[model samples]
Target: MTSAVLHSLGAARPYAGSRPLVLERIPVPAPRAGELLVKIERASLCHSDLSVVDGSRVRPLPMALGHEASGTVAAVGPGVPDVKDGDRVVMVFVPGCGDCRACDAGRPALCHRGAAANGSGDLLHGEAVLRTVDGERINHHLGVSAFSDYAVVARESAVVVDNDVPFDIAAMFGCAALTGIGAVLNSAKVSGGESVIVFGLGAVGLMAVMGAAQVAGTTVIAIDPLPEKQALAARCGARAAGAPADAEALVAEHAGDGVDVAIEAVGSARVMESCLGLLTRGGALVSVGLPHPDQVLSVQALQFAGMGKRLLGSYMGDANPARDIPAYLQMWRDGRLPVELLHTDTRPLAEINEGLDALADGRVVRRLFTLAP
Candidate 1:
């Protein structure tokens, strides 16, 4: 099997010149115990992947470069008897070890074991299944390197989906849909008749708009620098959408003093700081963005007590893939959530670097990478 492996980091863009990701035919080991060998059908380019390309978020180098994807289970490893070969599954970046303290508390996204493995670029069980032709080990990205033709993932990382769903649509449930929608439905817990604003109208941010709309009577506002993105946000579900310059005014108009909940999806410390200012006195700010580790966010210590506001960090939308993926699929089926509105374009696996350029340029919301079987 071949995979797009990142041998070096911090390549300057146009990416056409730097070419950080190298496509090479690598060897794939068979599924280990409690794992699955997935034949990836669709993968999506996310800002998280770009963070790695640009060296904003550091990780082990010479690693396979994708995580958000959907595929069919080619084979299921021993001890994962609940799943079977031929099952259609969406691969989650974090593979929860069911016995971990976080998993036991129903917060699988915070599973300590999973975090340790992902940080080391190994699968949940601490194994690297990919290697270069010269035998150099290629680290897995968050356990699901869906950029390759095939991926070996922990059984806990995959949530089975119905075969009827389109591969591209099913793929969305893995990351963008899961994190964005889950952030609204689970983390912030926005209710009907409340006002909500989302910062950064990228795939995750736009999905946040759609999630807020799903709640009846919610006044939704979207903020982005791009006018086209603002327009798309209106179509997605935002009652009002505009650039950052007009954000405070828009919030005052649509949400009165402030919004009940504000979601920061841009991963910008600056934008996150702005989200805090736009919230209502008792409102909460749910930050789902993955900023660089070294970047720091400053907030007045008195604000939490003075204004009764809460700042919460959300990872993977605090999603339990097993529970949320199916529910989200049903929401898509019922027509309440038009997730299809998020898809901007599609590219082949070979065009991944180019896709990253598009994502960074703000030319797309969600770009799918269709892979050959």
Candidate 2:
């Protein structure tokens, strides 16, 4: 089958503000041993994609621009036992090396060499899979370049799911949904009756709100500058929604002392500080946003030392895709995690620029690219 791959031309920075995504037809990839050739059904636009396109995040030029996606197994390479042709799967951001120190320690999210291996555009054998129109080499982004019609991914990176879930929503589970839900359930381990404050009410934040709501006696406080996002947060069971300016007041009104857990989904240093400030004594502050390298946090050392505050950095929400993806799907089936309401809009792959514009304008919460089946 022929495939149409989205290539990042050196022409212009697509994500700097808004620019067209360059699409080019390329040969379908052949899966190697321990690899899966997935025919992508849908790919979701992530904030990280925006950052990469706009040049805020540095990456190899002429790279494919998607990390979150869902698809069906078109073919499987040798020695792959768990997946077969026609199986539905969600691609995971981190391709864990099962024998790595982090993986051995039960922290696959922190796999040491995984990021470098995936980000360097080199395949497992130190080669590049994507090629240009002239047969020149191109780079792959985040291992699973599902922006293309098909992806050649490591077997470990594809999380097989039940055929019941819609491909569009499953695509979201690949990243935003997984990260948010995992942050609450795995990273924070939020228990019933806990009060949680989530800063930023985008797709990730909204999912955090949903995860928090699933636990009995949990109170969800959502913070967002946009009113539409706040409304969505309320729909997802936020006890109250407020802007950063009203964070302290909202905390006081909802929780007598302060929140038990505070999450920073927005990547601004200011927002992180605000989230830290909202936490009660000995409360946990989880940082989920990917701030720029130069971004620095200015915190009062005395407050952290005296109050025993804990700061935790979350990557992919501390997710172990093999375990977490199915659990989230089960939650969706049980109606505990409302995946339907999280989808704010859908567009064709060709209309990705418009969809991204809607995201930037705050017109939608989670916009998906419905690829041709």
The lowest-lDDT stretch of 10 consecutive residues in candidate 1 is 125-134
Off by over 4 Å in 1: none
Residue 222: error of model 1 in Å? 0.5
Q: What TM-score fits each model?
A: 0.98, 0.94
The stretch of ten residues in a row with the least summed lDDT in candidate 2 is 9-18
Off by over 4 Å in 2: 1-20, 124-126
Tens digit of per-residue lDDT, candidate 2, span 1-373: 3333334532342332435476677667688888889998888888887767655677776677788899999999998998999999999878887878999998887776677767787554345677765787767778888778888888878899989889977988888877898889889999999999999888888889998999999989999988878888898989999787788999999987889999889878888887777889988889998777689999997768899888988899999888888888888888887778878777777777766666766677778776674
Root-mean-square deviation per candidate? 1.1, 2.2
Query: Per-residue CA lDDT of candidate 1, range 1-373, in tens?
Result: 7688898888998997778888888877789999999999989999989998899888998889999999999998888988998999999988899898999999999999999999899988757878877878899999999899899999988999999999889988899988999899889999999999999988898888999999999999999999999999998889999889999999989989999999999887888888889888989999999888887889776769999999988899999999999998998999977778888877888888888888889998889987673
Q: How far does residue 1 in candidate 2 sit from its true spot (Å)?
A: 7.5
Model 2: how far residue 280 lies from native, Å: 0.6
lDDT, candidates in the order shown = 0.89, 0.81
